[model samples]
Target chain A: MSHDTVVTAAMLAIGDELLSGRTKDKNIGHLAELLTLSGIDLKEVRIVADDEEAIVEALNALRARYDYVFTSGGIGPTHDDITADAIAKAFGLPCDHDETAMTLLAEMYRRREMEFTEARQRMARMPRGAAHIANPVSTAPGFIIGNVYVMAGVPQVFQAMIDNVLPMLRTGTPVLSLAIACPYGEGDIGTPLAAIQKAHPDTSIGSYPRYIDQKFSTEIVVRGRAQAAIDAAGAEVHAMIGAIRRKKEVVENPSAEA
Target chain B: MSHDTVVTAAMLAIGDELLSGRTKDKNIGHLAELLTLSGIDLKEVRIVADDEEAIVEALNALRARYDYVFTSGGIGPTHDDITADAIAKAFGLPCDHDETAMTLLAEMYRRREMEFTEARQRMARMPRGAAHIANPVSTAPGFIIGNVYVMAGVPQVFQAMIDNVLPMLRTGTPVLSLAIACPYGEGDIGTPLAAIQKAHPDTSIGSYPRYIDQKFSTEIVVRGRAQAAIDAAGAEVHAMIGAIRRKKEVVENPSAEA
Candidate 1:
């Protein structure tokens, strides 16, 4: 798998609860992980409030920029749920209840002996010429309009929808990564790390700092589609870390913590 | 303080680690909660990879739309830390090492008997004519340029910077909320709930469903700055729930779950 063959994606999270801090978004990370496993690159994520204009603007921007745009929340049976209408406006299409979605909801309600009200039926609405994304948790189905796949906010339901939708989309080459951790601050290794990154332009190297057991440590990860590139980059980073450790022994007095 | 005086903010979380799903974001939720307590409305959040163009685009858009734009990540001492350069480009200002920030970092390093390298000094760079946001966790100081505040990616450092910067900004009237949970699905109450929302247009009502105890339940929350409006809307919701319960008893067979 080559770097040029990578498929790209973007996610739009729609809800006032998310923007207001009432809800900590779990779907974005979940989708990012799922997309990675499916060989899709998640390029960007935007969380906008439950405003029609905001939703429409973000949806259009992401759909145009990426191969796929996944949206979560704002598809419920509430008054504030306006994702379907907003997505419709983004594509210049009319949004209405789908027969398949409505039938599924009706049957589920009938089994539970609950009345399928207008609000519940609202979940059936989607942009014209959209394909339905099956929901195994609840009968309310999500839909795919253009490149955007609208999903529920609930964690369980969203994951279920992803499981159903993943097989329907095309996957690309999976990204591979190698991580090397050393008990040193980022500043101690930043210079050489940059050189290693420059040497391996195809692979992206990230330095993440962690404080564990009252000791500063850094984890450097090299990621790329090419195994040889990743291996070369990883070896350089490992050598760099070893040199930095030897330099610390010669320059600074060794403390028990160090 | 009134509805018209509400202060709004947006957040831009920049990192490849986040977009790759290697790190679950902790700063957005923390900042959202902190801003809410300080009477600031967090209206939007955008997460982008470690790309300069993406950061500049999002920074410009969010800064223009909201009263304040808060950015987290990419302010580290690593090569991928390009946020400062991107922010400077966005504001059409030159990015240089701030004297105050550099002085602080130098003193901290000197005390620890460590040399202040160029990579470490990279944290001192900011858009020209920007004020510094102190980082108590680490010596690397964040900065405020125009309405956008650039902070560290590390959660501890980001939170400390927020603590230092929040007092310098203006806050609005605190928003209040009231929540009531009922064992009825959103569909069962959507019709009357819409009427309640219409009656109190100033307040926002959100319906969140939960699957608990093998039965479906809904939590309706009304939020606004006005207590009287919240009470009025809340009373209507409570009354509607009671009416729906009575109607359910007459229409369907009683069940232990209901």
Candidate 2:
């Protein structure tokens, strides 16, 4: 409820598939970008296997440290889907079939004329005293217990659940960033850029190098909680890059300099 | 250099850009796939900011827990490039510019007719007694200290570093995987699949649900250390899927059953 202070969160991506490299995780990036834009700082991310002990250990550690913890994967109908059980273990709660969830799922299946099979009923399981995070894309639901929000591994379902959870949490001041293109690489601007970063301690300046068209170039991105700080640091970076370009041109061409 | 036992690994992705959503990391997946295929179990992955303390703490934790710890990012020419410092601190050793790295990088710049600038010189810094991981894409080499492999964050450079490091380390038996496509979703086969999983304790069975073409589908992936176990689980999974399909067809088309 409080937006005055930073809302820090961590992601626990639980799945053997992720660790085994069977699934190239897309949820981490998607959730990261959303959290950044929403002003919630995603401070850390931990990817662990589907083993319940592994999930419980990671979940407990993360939930205690960060304001909110988001977990994806392992809440489906299969036996391997033990995230719900893990969450309960982490919070010292009981995980069992919830009447509300079962009723909703049953109604949806009945409308579609599909039987609510025993395995499908597994989807109704949730941590005691947890609220359901709607998965609009699918009939099954993801739940929130304590600070942890359990979501599906499927990208579409995870994304939909993310949308449902984002509105309920607290957010901090959105970060403002400005990027300056430097025709030169980090080697060319690192010194001057470090000076600018030190001069504006409020701004965090980063130099990213790219090799394009057989030449190396860098992009200096200045980020800060406030606009003025980012602009101040960004201006210095732009001027520094301009000076380097001119100096290089002059050194390469003595006649042009004269 | 022992390939008899399972080699475990953890990746520490260091960068504020990754946390800020400015850069979506491709290194994690790339390295994960490579490690998996190399018979190394990438057990866990941690993404932290470029902060020195964060890097040092994560590096320490990972290096101690896993057989090998692979770190990507924050090893460059900029002031934010503090991975080398962190690695050195974690190992309780001095981090200084190495003569070998300096010589190699210096010659690389000289060959290209570029100045060996002070910022570029930062790339030569490494933990005392660390071995350089060759970067063919860019002459700026990554260093390996103890069991930890420090690599460039750029996908191309990270990949090149991975190739250099893989052959040097020991690996376990390659994991064999079999994926069976099930037209029905998890709800239809989750119970039977769980039974098959219980029957085959050696194999790890995973049910992945997909929302495709406005219908639910699932893929059951069976993974194991040996072919016989994978084959045994694979056969049961196939047979189970076939039986489900036949039963569903009979129920949907009563006239066809006659």
Report DockQ per prediction, comma-separated.
0.72, 0.78
Task: Give the 10-residue window scoring lowest on summed lDDT in candidate 2 chain B.
Answer: B1-10
The i-RMS of every model, in angstroms, reads 1.1, 1.1
Error of 2 at B155 (Å): 0.6
Query: Per-model C-alpha lDDT, please?
Result: 0.88, 0.88
How does model 2 fare in lDDT?
Answer: 0.88
The sequence of per-residue lDDT tens digits that candidate 2 reaches over residues B208-252 is: 888887788988999888899899999999999889878888888
Query: What is the overall TM-score of model 1 with all chains considered together?
Result: 0.95
- Name model 1 segments beyond 4 Å from true: A1-3, A213-215, A252-258, B1-3, B251-258
Give every collision pair in model 2.
Answer: none
RMSD of 2: 2.1
TM-score of chain B of each: 0.93, 0.96
CAPRI quality level assigned to candidate 1 from its DockQ score: medium
lDDT digits (tens) for residues A138-246 of candidate 1: 7788898877899998888889998999998888888888888777888888788898899889899998888665455788889988899899988888888778778
Q: Write the per-residue lDDT of candidate 2 for residues A100-130, one digit (tens) a residue.
A: 9999999999998787889889999988999
- Candidate 1 residue-wise lDDT at B152: 88
